[model samples]
Target: MTLATVESGFNGEPAVFTAELKPHRSLGPIGFRVLMGLSVAVTLINVVFFLATNALPVAMFFGLDLALLYGAFWLNYRAARAREIVRLSRNQLDIHKVTPAGFVRKSQYNPFWARFDVARHAEFGITDMAVVERARRTTLGKFLGPEERDSFAKAFTAALADIKRRV
Candidate 1:
C-alpha cells in the first residue's frame, strides 16, 4: 500500500500529523491495457491453431481463460480504491476507513486515553498495528506492506508521544 504522511492543522496552531493510506496498484491502466492486449493476441493465435486442428472445445476454453483473466484484473482494480486516512491532533486521534464499495467506517479516541499498539515479527517486520483505548481496538493499515507499516508506526508513535507531552 501507499502511505503518505502529511502535516496539517486548522487556525494558527502547530501542524498535526495526518496519514493517507491506500492499497498499492502495481499495474496502472496503461500497463493493464498492454498486458491484456498481449494476452488477447496470444489467445487469438491459440484459437486459430486449435480451430485448424479441429479442436473446437479447446478454442472455447481459451476464450473462457481470457474472460477469467479480465475478471481478475477488474477485481484488483476495484480493491485498489479502498483507503484509510489517519489524523492525530492534540485532543483527538481519528481513523477513517473507506472500502471499495464506498462504505465508510470511522473511529475516534481521546488522545490522552488512546494507545498506539504494534505487533512485530523478526522476519516480516511489523505485522499489525492498532489504536487501543480502554475496551476499543481499531486496526490500522491492514493493506500496508511491512515497510510501509514500519514507517507509519514510527511516525504515528512519535506524533502520539508529542501530543501527550503537550498535555
Candidate 2:
C-alpha cells in the first residue's frame, strides 16, 4: 500500500509529512501463481511431446528453462520486500530503508539545513532524487516510477518550505 500522511505537529507546530514508498508490481499474488501454473503446464505438455518423439534431451532442456523462470520470479518477489519510509518534521527529516534481506538503514537531516535535489533527464523526466545536508546526501524512492517520483518531490519540497517558513 502507498501511504502519504501530513499531520500537524504537537503544540501547534508546522505540519509533518510522512510517506511510505514501495515497488509497484503489476501482478498480484494470485495472478503470479496462475501465471506460473499456466507456464509450467504448457512447458510440461511440450516436454512430453518431445519425449514421445525420442527427443529426451529436449525435454530435459525444457525442464531447465522452467527452473530458470521460476528462479527469476522468486527473486523478483523477494526483492519486493524492500521499502522506503520518509518522515519530514519541523526539526528533522528521517529516512528509513529496508532491504529485501531484512537489513535496515536510517538517515537523519536537519529540515532547516537540508536541500531537496532532483535530477532530471530530457526524455525520462526525473531520474533521481535525494536530500542533501551539508556534504551528506541520502537517496530516496529508488523503487518509484518517474511520475510518482515527481509528485513526491513536489510534496516533499512543499513540506520543507512550510517548515522553513514556520521557523
Provide backbone clash counts, one per model.
Answer: 0, 0
After the best TM-score superposition of candidate 1, give how far the Cα of residue 16 lies from its true spot, in angstroms: 0.6
TM agreement with the true structure for every prediction: 0.89, 0.88
| Alpha-carbon local distance difference test for all models | 0.85, 0.83
lDDT of 2 by residue, 1-167 (tens): 11222222112434399888888888889998999899899998999999999999999999999999989989998889888878876787878777877666777788899999999999999999999988999998888999899999999999889889996
The alpha-carbon lDDT assigned to residue 161 of candidate 1 equals 93
- Residue 101 of model 1, lDDT score: 77
**Number of the top candidate by lDDT?**
1
Cα lDDT, model 2, residue 139: 92
